[model samples]
Target: MSDALGYASPQHYPAVVTDRWGRVETTLVNDGTAFGMILRGNRFEGKSVDGLALVGPPVGSNPPTLCDGDLCSCTIEWRMPIEVSLDGAGPSRVSLSAHLVLGDPTPNRGIDSVGVTLTLHLPTGVVATTTPQELIENALLDLQRLLPDGTRLLACISCAFSDYSPAGTAFIGSMACFRDRKDAYRAVSGKRDMYDIWSAMSGVVQETYHCPDFARRRPGSGYRG
Candidate 1:
């Protein structure tokens, strides 16, 4: 949020936001660059902010009104710094970008359906490792592969990263009951312990995750060593 970051003044600037699902939204940053950073950084604060993206609305305009179709059809772009530790080899820094679309294209009454496009950029020599190979091997029960690219993988519903990382993953889709922004707001501000929130998200892959795929070690899943 530094002016050095090439951001415009708050009163006249629109901030780009990315949600956990990788959905990008542009909204008028109320205060200024610093304030915008607060909003983006505190995404857990509510539905409006699960994360922030590189997309934004025009300057001086209110946040765009997204229609059901917009949320359903929007493909979000996300970038994050990740550490991928393969077996016990070591942890490598990787750039993770997940292209996530919100809702079910074909709603399945009780089951939420989501489409995901994943792009992973590993370090210079990391691609040669079998880590990527293992990641696709130990997938979830419902995971279905649609395409594969060296280190990049894609699935219709979601994929798993347990084989390589020895850690479980989460798949969050945008369903009506699950996608409620209001509900997300309640989560971040509720009386729930911060650790509990983190624990809940960090636990073994649960049914809540449904969007673009992400990987993390599940509690009590056992050590990679």
Candidate 2:
């Protein structure tokens, strides 16, 4: 089913009457339930917004376009009317209709990136935009630091870290995934160590290994299989 439109309900307010004697009186009438807040736009970083109209796809759907360097190509656009409350403040209301351009690219070859553009329709409208690449780089640094000191890089793009592990060395052509034997040979022929091989082609493999913690070695077992 399609999503419902925002502002589809009505809100009722109470009536107050003032007499000629300058006495103010109130007429109490039972009003229906409060209108549900319809946030029309997509939430970025968990901020609720209303009067947000999307001109393109909602968000995060990748368009098959190549990005230059680390900049992401524009993929989604938004059109919003004025009087939009961004954070429940009077100044938070939009002064003019505005357009927001959003871009997000899947990181197949390099660092992933995000982009945003805000264009106001006013004559002296302020344009505010940023990709926050520095913030992302800092966050990536934090993520890398979170890994264990002995962590070996693994590049399995198909499987999540929690779902799989390095089982054994996969000579590329042996796995049904490699189309060219030469490419496979170049990848795995010189891989003498497990860590080196895992780091180089982690995005191309799905080698699931058993990780049994704290197990007693069996008699004459040559390393844990």
Candidate 3:
């Protein structure tokens, strides 16, 4: 059966956290958060986002080098607006998307990256399907299982030290993660540029890129994911 949309159903609000024994810590999803939030336009999103990236190990003149003086270690692209019938009766339609490009191709070509992969959530219900969150999450997790050991989805988006910029952000969203990858933020501030200056303390990592030092977002830190 399809789950009905209600005040508590959307995954936008801060999520519940449980103890090791699965005991509830807070009755409300908004507990421990600085402010309550609501998600907008999430239902229309594609169940999954497809992406591609190039990765290589460096064997250069110096040993301590990491993706320097060469093509970026990775690049990814996600195509979207791919939609399906929530009730399984209507024709599938592609969702609207934007133009995006990540990096310059390596000058040398015989070994350019070309592997392909798909990321989509599959319908989970036995007799009926809601959107496709179940389907898509399963597919993405399965892909992670097939990846080489040590490969991870670590990024600023999931890091505890990072947060959205109130002043503004990149089109997708502005986030800050210091290059050193700390266990916590060096400092929190209301000034527009304080985030940048604090980030400079360790160094600024290229936003959205695979970073050398990545830590998961702390639980109950006001982040949804």
Candidate 4:
């Protein structure tokens, strides 16, 4: 009933949680930075069936409300601790985890959980340049670990730069999606620009080179590209 947090639904981008009564709450706790969320309503009494709990402000007729039901609402607050670091100047992976506290009086439902991953766009100065061959070779190395056996490398169509940071040192580019992580790795290896030379070249090069290697190698053995 209360549109304070808006309509709740599982939409892409910021993770959203909605109740059966049309109350919506959106959370972006996956960022590499620390953040917190607090929702006060009369509908949140205990933990939801899905293990989600309602926090409370205590001592009031207008408790945290979940729906139209006459149940006392509670306050639910979540604090997410994020850690971020750049492996190179290209793309970086972020891992997130958090502790959720529901209700203040009894501290009923509290738990620790892992959130989603947040991809951060790094500056260009942080990334190193590589040739087409090198890019493909690196991609192949990453794909060998992500893809299952028998997966083959396919054509990698590069995309153009849609936006660039103000400093002009870095540019944001897009690429065609691969069938799987393995497919993505393979596609990244090949050089083929989609829009312009710069974007295509950068996208293909980055994608191919950024994947993590997961293959088992013998002592003194080098990567097979």
Ranking by TM-score: 1, 3, 2, 4
Deviation of model 1 at 24, angstroms: 7.5
The numbered model that scores best in lDDT is 3
Clashes of 3: 6
* Candidate-wise lDDT, in order: 0.30, 0.25, 0.31, 0.25
The residue-by-residue lDDT of candidate 3 on 150-170, one tens digit each, is 333343444556554455443
Residues 1-225 of candidate 4: C-alpha lDDT, one tens digit per residue: 112111232212233333223344545321111122333332222212112334443334433433322122222222222122333123233322211222222234332221121121223222122221112223333433333333222212111111112222211112222222332233332223212223222221111112222222232221111
lDDT of 1 by residue, 1-225 (tens): 233221244332233344334433444332211112322222211112212232343222223223321232234444433344333344455554444444433444221333444444655432222112112122222122221232222221122322112233323311111111223322442234222333223222212222233333332321221
Candidate with maximal TM-score: 1
User: In model 3, what are the clashing residue pairs, if there are any?
Assistant: 81-95, 120-136, 121-135, 121-136, 122-135, 122-136
Which segments of model 1 are wrong by more than 4 Å? Answer: 1-72, 86-88, 103-113, 125-225
RMSD values for the candidates in order, in angstroms, are 14.2, 22.5, 20.6, 18.4
TM-score of each: 0.31, 0.20, 0.28, 0.20
Q: What's model 3's lDDT at 87?
A: 39
| Model 4 segments more than 4 A misplaced | 1-13, 30-35, 40-225
Order the candidates by lDDT, highest first.
3, 1, 4, 2
lDDT for each residue of candidate 2 in 94-197, tens digit (9 for 90 to 100): 32211222244454643254322333343234433332322212222233234334322121111122111235322111111121222332334222432343
lDDT of candidate 1 at residue 116, scale 0 to 100: 45
